[model samples]
Target chain A: MATMTIAKAITSGLRAVLADDPKTLIMGEDIGKLGGVYRVTEGLQAEFGADRVVDTPLAESGILGTAIGLSFRGYRPICEIQFDGFVFPAFNQITTQLAKIRSRSSGMLSAPVVIRIPYGGGIGSIEHHSESPEALFAHTAGLRIITPSNPHDAYWMTQQAVACQDPVIIFEPKRRYWLKGEVDTESAGRDAFSAQVVREGTDVTIVAYGPLVPVALAAAEAAQEDGNSVEVIDLRSISPIDFDTVTASVEKTGRLIVTHEAPTFGGIGGEIAARVAERAFLSMEAPVLRVGGFHMPYPLAKVEEQYLPDIDRLLEALDRSLAY
Target chain B: MGAEHLPASEFDIEELEQSLVTSDPADAPPLVQLMAPDGSLREDTKYGHYAAHLDGEALRAMYRDMALVRRFDQEATALQRQGQLLLWPPLLGQEAAQIGSGTALQAQDYVFPTYREHGVALTRGLELSKVLRLFRGVSNGGWDPRESNFHLYTLVLAAQSLHAVGYAMGVQRDGDDAVTVAYFGDGASSEGDVHESMVFAASNQSPVVFFCQNNHWAISVPTEVQSRIPLSNRASGYGFPGVRVDGNDVVAVHAVTRWALERARSGKGPVLIEAFTYRMSAHTTADDPTKYRELAEEEKWRERDPLLRLERYLRSTNTAGQDFFDQIAAEADKLAASTRADVLAMEAPDFEDHFANVYAEPHPLIREELEWHRQYQAGFAEETAGQAEGEAR
Candidate 1:
């Protein structure tokens, strides 16, 4: 058990995985000597040496492509894509090679690779820094995408992603990287792929992932002031989504509000809304609503907050759900 | 004279001949010729070393693989015309280049391919229906790479090259004898990934083979724009031996690939083999070759067709009679029909499949999303039911 920020928790988790498995390696640009731009991989290279903690060239595609090849050769490589927007250059390798290699191999080989990217808006970053491309990866078959909203999950899920046989895309909310929590290092509880109920309520179910999970929790806290109990669910896994928890909460609440920083059209929120309408239609007292980014490229830094789903946007969606 | 300014010395031909088939190091540049197009033996060369490896039946099998792959290429073009597929990249004349290098790989060796290597995919044992699904927009990749030791088909040009080099590095780290072969077109030779792959492979001595099929075009761009010198000459700058082979010659491709593989396995390092072939069709079904290149260029390549060259060589040697040719043709037709049937029979993937394999362990957000989707779906069903009840009432 330890109290730490999400950044520290992730580093600790990486250290533990490296210690446990000899084959586990961490490779990324600036990860070796610079300890990553966010320092999530701080001190890992010095502790593990350059062989295990590699500082590769400034090539995202090369990092991921190599990681796939390494995974094929029985080494579990955890690749860091540096930033959310930077991951697109490697998207071809991820979608075409890493994701499909498993099923395309028809169970003959398991990729066992983890691609870590710092995602979402709110940091007042430049263009291409706060985009959400989770829907793209989630839509692709044979890939497992997970994002941790807190320190506890950041610690546990990082290890779980490293251990999983399939290639896992672990999206860490860059904005929430500093958020602190108490993490039980010994017990990761359920696998990192399942969703976690962060707050218990009965009035409405709020679903959010990555950075939006913390925003949803804040909204739940604020909603308590109005005496409207909000159930908040942190979506740990984006693909192979844990629907059981979501449906159970929706069944109890009778209303749902899904939130994400990505565009609403064909977003993971859309997928959730359609699924809920199919399975929990009779239990719904109000129509499911979504709070998401607009159908535009993630805007420049100045107006990014407006482009991202914040507590206010989530609360607004909650109010809409209540009206429905 | 400065070391750099020295004229490139002519390679010793005698040394090249002695080490042509054997893995021994000769003073010559790597064995660049094992079988000439004329079917006549190189008198000064040690052709006996590769004689046992080439059989009449095997040559015919290579020919059949090329013909069948070309037929599928034609069918895919037709399907795209009929709106069955959104796009198709045809490998009409580069059959021998793909099949030869593909067959050269051992069971353990891995392959990294670009999108146009459908012939390579067939040789790697991928199902035809699975390959079609990618173009049909049903899936991003239709088959597994680990089963055949073949990576997924990359659409982005030359991206797979870096992956191959990285995988080759892993092979070195694991102390494995397996080498990785990266298949890319001449246009990809100009991409940054290809250069990075060569540099990394050279620096690390990663066991990789760069198999460049110089089919003369990258969409609208010609080969000259991509390279001023021959593509093989580019490898010398990367600190590895490079060879040019008649890409249309299956026997030559096999020999060169086998030699490169042997060198890589023996820890001799990487090699680049440029298969100088031609693309008989458009780059993809969406492309129009007539808009860019002249008809004469196409006609000239047609005369040196890879399939015809092999057929002529086999016939001149009495290795393939009419009966053998007919049998192969029948087999190829059956393969095409079976492939079509498989494509038609492929089941539409289930909706839940989208949520199933994102991670080895269950993710909380994914669980929530999946549950949310179920509820969302159920709501629609309920609405439908209520509407039906209202109508009945």
Candidate 2:
């Protein structure tokens, strides 16, 4: 076991996997010499060599398309999309080719390719650098989406995504990259789709994922001070959500609030709310409330805080759900 | 005077024939041809070595593959017209391009084909009937690429070119000599995906071949609309070799593709092959060619029919007896009958199967959706019960 930042844990996990598997390859722009903008892939190119940690051309479509082909050749390619906003260039390949290849081939072939995208807001970064595109992938079929909140989950979830036969998109919360936690190097920490109840309480359940996890925890602590017991759930897997866990929690609490940095309209929170309503409708004390960014393009740094869901916003949603 | 007011000149058959193959007359790139339209064997010194392996046996086999593929393509079009299939993309005039380039590859080599490579699928040994499953709307992917090392047909324009480059890169890293080839149309050359793939292939020196069948049309748009210059010439800008072959001539196509694959396999990097053929049929079964193209232009391409050229060569060489030609015709018929039977026999997949393989692992969303579907299906039970009661009354 080692204590490391979420970024280091991910690097360690990727290193462990790349060292273990000869077929696994790392490819992206600036991933080789620069070791990634966040330095998560630092020291890896030195260890793995250029063949393993490849610095691709400045084209996202080329990166993903080629990764799909490499997957056909039985190579597990880990493609790094430099930023969340830049993933749109490869959207056609990711959605049409990588996502559909397995089902299209009737399961004879699978693209065990992991597309790593550093997503979400709160870093006060420039436009296109800080945007949450999870809902886009989560809404898409034939894609497995996962996001980890802490180092332990980050380290393990990455390996799990690589092990997955289908195309897995890892939406790493860029703002949470420096958050440190204990990660087990001896084994994988948890399943990719399982949601963890980070904080346990009774009155209401606040579900969050990626960067919003810290906000959820802070909101839970604030709610405790306000004399309301609010449970916080980290949705590790955004696609095949751990609805059983969420349903159980919502049933016990009889209230739920889903939060994220993505737009409130047609976001993943809406899907979670709908699913929870379907499964635990009678148990709900009120309509599932959501706390997220407004329905607009992610604003620039100066007003990003107001656009993003913070502890105040989470608590407000929680208080509303509980008051019902 | 305007051409509409002036009397037309008497059309000369020989002049028209000369014009079709001449670069100056059509303002098109000169096509690399091995066998002339008259079936006479003429050698091009540059590409002769690649075709050295094409003996009588190889020629006969290529002819057989092309014949059967054409028959199967016709049957699929008929099926679509009969409402059995949702749609069909006919690989009508470019048989030589598909069969020759497809057959030239070694077993270890892989192909990424666009939606219209029916002949390539046949050459690669996928069931001719299985190819119709996608058009029939029963399967998401028509056949397993693993079985033949020919990937599923990509409907998205030029997407497969990137995949092919990537696969070729993989082959290079593995220290293997296998090549990867992607097949797309002339119009697909305009896609950014193709440009990116070429750039990546050139930079990495990836072992890939971009095989573009310039069949002269992309639905209603002509090939000229896609590129002002020859599509092959674009490869030079990408820093790679490019060759324009007579797509209607199977012998030349096989030789050219072999040469490109050799370059790629030997780690010389990617090559672009422009197969100058024409689309003899409509873009697909659903299209109206009469609205977009001229009958006179269609007649010009018909005179240079790929199958007729091959048949002429076989006869002029005395390589195939009349009985051999008869056997090929019989085989094509048998293929059509069997393919039609297989297509007719194919049942629609269970509705639940749609939700089954969305994820390799069982997904809760899929499960929830499947369950909801089950209840929705159960909603029809009361109607059946009421019908039974009415009968009893």
Docking class of 1: incorrect
Score chain B of each candidate by TM-score.
0.87, 0.90
Top TM-score: which candidate number? 2
* lDDT of residue B94 for candidate 1: 92
Worst 10 residues of 1 chain A by lDDT: A100-109
lDDT of 1 by residue, A44-96 (tens): 88898877898776777778877877776778999998888899878878887
Per-residue alpha-carbon lDDT of candidate 1 for residues B213-321, written as tens digits (9 for 90 to 100):
9998888899889877788878888788888877887777777788888888888788999998898999888889899999999998888787888887788899888
Which residue pairs of candidate 2 clash?
Answer: A104-B141
Model 1 chain A, TM-score vs. native: 0.97
**Top candidate, metric lDDT:** 2
Interface RMSD of each: 6.2, 9.7
